[model samples]
Target chain A: MEENIKFLRSGILAPIKKWGTHWSLWPVHLVTACCGAELAHAFASGYDGERIGALNYGIARQTNLIIVEGAITRKMARVLRITWEQMPDPKFVIIMGTCGLNGGVFWNSYHLVKPFEVVPVNYFIPGCPSTPEALLRGIRQLQNEIRTGEPRSSIEFEKVDLGKGKMMPVTPKSPKKISLAPSIVVNVPRKADEETKKLADEISKLGLATTVTGKNRIALRVEKDELVDAAKKLQNFGFDHVKNVNVIDVPNEDKFIVEYHLGSYSKRELMPVVLNLFTELPRSEPKLKSLAKIFPSADYMEREMHDFFGVVFEGNEWMGRKFLLAPDTPEYPLKKDFKLEEEKYLR
Target chain B: MEALVISHQKQIGDKMLEGLISGLFKIFTSNMMNIPLIEPLVDYLMQIPLVNLLVALILWRPFFAVIILPGLVGLLIYLLWIVYWERKLTARVQWRVGPIEVARPIRGAIQALADGIRYFFQEAIIHREAHKIYYIQLPILAFIPILLPLLFIPAGNVVGIKTPYGIQLIVAFIALIPLFIVAMGWASHSRFAYIGSLREAFMYFAYEIPFIIAVVAMIYVYGSGDPYVAVEKQNIPGAVLNPLAFIVYIIAMIMATSRLPFEIPEADQEIAFGPFVEYSGILFGLVMTLLYEKLYLMALLFVILFLGGWEGFYVGILGDFCAPLVLFIKTVVVISVLVIVRSVYARYRLDQAIRLGWTSYLTLSIAALILGMFVGVLV
Candidate 1:
């Protein structure tokens, strides 16, 4: 394949092909992350990527470039791969973010995946959210690479001794560290009204503990087995929608704290209130009764939680399938022990 | 006497074939291009055996009409010029310098050329799911309609084929271009392509009726469909005679060519070039330009019906070349003025364009037709 590509580029037609490819570097508009906003800026009237002959094309197949903007989560990795696979050859990829290099602000995020792992990159534009000008510079570099048949950086850097030039302060130590034993508290002490106390009293019978977390917020803690019963009673109490499902891995405690944030759209008065129905399960057997039937909106969120933490929402059907993550992605990535590769600073 | 008659008939048949070949030369050379500057050169070239035939084929009025001026060469130049102009004009309007880096001296005029070359070399991927035959054939096949109309559209005395219904035939052939686009989407076998094809079909219905009616109104006012007759009769251009039909035609033209305000079917942001979602490389380029070519064809017809076709001061030196040049310039100017919508107006939704086409354009075209009938009676 390498030889074939070289052969095609070795004749009088080489310059023509390169020139054509450079001017028509239409990037497929796949908005994967926050950097996509800057990409829009680059293409929009402010920067006008068209002035550089890099229009933001809409489809994958017709486009010759992919500006993999910012971070790729576990879920978006598969999409990135599929989109890359679909584009025609002589294609180029420009990863436009510090996150793409080593995760930037999401350096240790459970869901973040490196974009370079998904697609062969032609250029890396480094910034937290790379500026539209920086993005255009990256495109200019790609154009230069196409024209000259050699990959070259847009700017040159000369070495500067930071310590010698100025009176530099000693490097500050990172103040925060991952908690070895998190208290995992969902329910804190708070006062409750008679109506709330009555609701809590009714809910506490089906659970181990109850607390009014805040205004319009209630928390019920239950054993893994009693989760369904509590969800059913909450539905009966007019909380008809499950806002989200989340799993917190407490490796030190040898357990997983699974929480379902429930709300109501069908019942008017209950609309502002969110009830957190949570349960503790042994890490060895992190299976919980599914409340999917009681709250239909919980189904998709349950699948996502299952994907991240491997906590089985027992009655839900898609327990093992990778709904949000790529099939080849490491399993149960949100588990406390799961580690992304450490970032390497440039010398 | 029968034997003598048979020999005489054979001699006449031989003379007819000879006459036809020699007929090619008469049209090629007589009152040939009169550019005094190039007259000696043309005459010198006319003496060469094969080069003369080539020159004759090139300068031969009808042959030149289809292949050079308003046909292949004209189409090529228009494609190059319009693509650049559309981007540059849109950029200027949007407050940016458009495509100046490539051949900066000419203001990136060759940007389209470079893109074309790139597409030529780029891998034309035929996905496994596509219906291989039709997927490959449709883009090439679409050219038939786009090119077929060029034969009948007259530029003054020059026409590939003279027919009374030249205007109608051009419209008919131009309408056929959309069916192939729908076929392409079907052949692509993708979800977006399917949606795009449906939109293209909806758009076809939305515009084609009013487009025909607008043309019909013009034909009624002109009293004939022959372009020459329309041109000859237009002491006042058709736009002046039937202004409502002119409005209807321009709007329908936008919808037909899938320009900005009515560019719903191939809304690049919404459906990713619609029916052309799956096309890549050269196939993508070809499908992309299909609309521009269709626009060129309709603009040619638009000029003939409204802008006085080829009614410009005759460049006596160039002889027959003068009319096609005038018509080409008129078509280009109309298109240049028309493309301002790209930067000025946002694309309409499929339903909005349809409603506009079906209700407002239809009513105006019908009104134009009624007015045309009254005017026809007066004439």
Candidate 2:
């Protein structure tokens, strides 16, 4: 990479090369988040980034500079890298917003990726969604770097000691009351209305554990093999659709609790009531009968659950395949023991 | 007797070499440009042995037409001027100052120079999938058709190849330019390039027929295919004689050169500059200017057809060279005015531009042809 920059600076026409690159910093903007809006404002009539010779171009192959806007997610990181690689030699990258710098509001999020880790960033404009002025400043700093062989911050803040006359605040510690083997509770008993209680009694007739969880909610626990039977009986009970499919990983108990929230649009009275149907499977071989056949809406949700938790829905066609995640993402991200790589910041 | 005969043959060979050199010198001096402003300097230089030959060759009319004014050198200057002017003009239209930071003292007039230098040094990547030979060769090859038209496009007494079919030759060469562009797209082998080249071929058919008809109309109105005759007969100017043809020619110029309204083939936003999408660095810079060069050629033809060709007030100092200077200035002005359309209008869709070209635009050209025929008889 330095060889490319060196080639531009070593020739007899180096001054001309440097001058052109400095002024003609056409950015192929990779808009990942809200900072893209600020980028537009910078180039629009108000700020007019083109006045300084920084035009916004569309193609990655023809342009020299890339302005990465906001946070790059796990999926977008691949795209960012590809765009960078597609660009010709002596290309520069200026990442905008605090998200691109350190993830901003999405700090330590499982899906958020630090852009600097993917490409060599020339300048960073720090803000949640950086102001357009800061974006222009970032471009100016990059221009300055091209002219001189060194990079510097556009704005420098003075290090002030606020603790000089006041008491320094104590550093906080991590909370000590974390439960080691916390119980995974899906059915918390609550005082239900008479109608919900009567409905719970009717569901209990299927020879399963039933509890009234809330005013218009009931929880039914069935064995893994009896899940299909329970869903068929519930469909007959006017729970015509599966509203959501979720998987809870209980590492300490060595079990996976799968829940299907059932609701109805066909039956008027059952429209307001939510029936929580759950079943447990052994952690090592977490397979359960899919309710997708009984409820067509459950198909996509079941596939998504399979993507996150690696829970095999025995009869669902999309059970073993990955969905709703980038191809490069780690498998079973929602598993309790799956550890994400912690981001380390250097001083 | 045998030795004497051999010596006689050697003397004949030496005489032929001498005659060849002096004959070329006679041709150069006879047709040399008579610029009064540089007379004293040229006279002083003429006394020198070796340098005088070089000086006379440069001032020679045929060489001057091909290499100097309204030719390669003029094209280079126009390229630098127009790129910067287009950018600055668009900036002004949008209420901005535009590209003034590069050389602030000159108001960034040399911005294009800097860009050219940067592109010159940057890497030119030929992707793995590209046709390596054609991908590398096509941009340079495209310049042939572009420069060839300059040979027949006369500016008064200065012309590379004076011909009876001057207008036809120029039009034919101009038509060949799009084939190179289409070939460039075929070599790139990328999806965007494929789409871009396909659009270029479609646009070629869309505007080519009407463009030819419009030129034919002018040819009819002028009563000859020669540019000199065309200019000489235009006391009323061709535009006044055949206004419909003038309008048709202007629209054809826009469509042929891929200016904003008909910029379907290389729509940067839609298909990422189409056939040139895969090119980078110096290769991209070369491909980028192909349209502008084509525009310059077509505009020259335009001035010769509708506008009076090189018929401006003759400068006494420039003499025979005055014609090319006036012609170059007029062509530049025509293009400068044309550049305003880029910022003013939005691009038309491929289908819409094609439909307009084949239907209404073609009808207009045919009508222009009829008008030219009627006017040709009266004039």
Poorest lDDT segment (10 consecutive residues) of candidate 2 chain B: B114-123
Per-candidate local distance difference test = 0.85, 0.90
Best by DockQ: 2
Best by TM-score: 2
Worst 10 residues of 1 chain A by lDDT: A168-177
* Candidate 2 lDDT by residue in tens digits, A1-347: 77866665686778877887888888999998899999999998899898788889999998899999988998999999999999997799999999888889988777887898999988989997899989989898898899898999877799976664565455333332324578789999999789989878887886767999999998988888888888888888788999999898888788999999999999998889998999898999988888888999999999999888899998899867777887767888888777766444331
Could you tell me the lDDT of residue B42 within candidate 1? 79
DockQ of each: 0.58, 0.67
Candidate 1 runs further than 4 Å off? A1-7, A108-110, A160-187, A191-281, A284-305, A310-323, A339-347, B1-27
lDDT of 1: 0.85
lDDT of 2 by residue, B272-347 (tens): 9999999999999999999999999999999999889999888897788899998999999999999899999999
Q: Residue A346, candidate 1: how far off, in angstroms?
A: 11
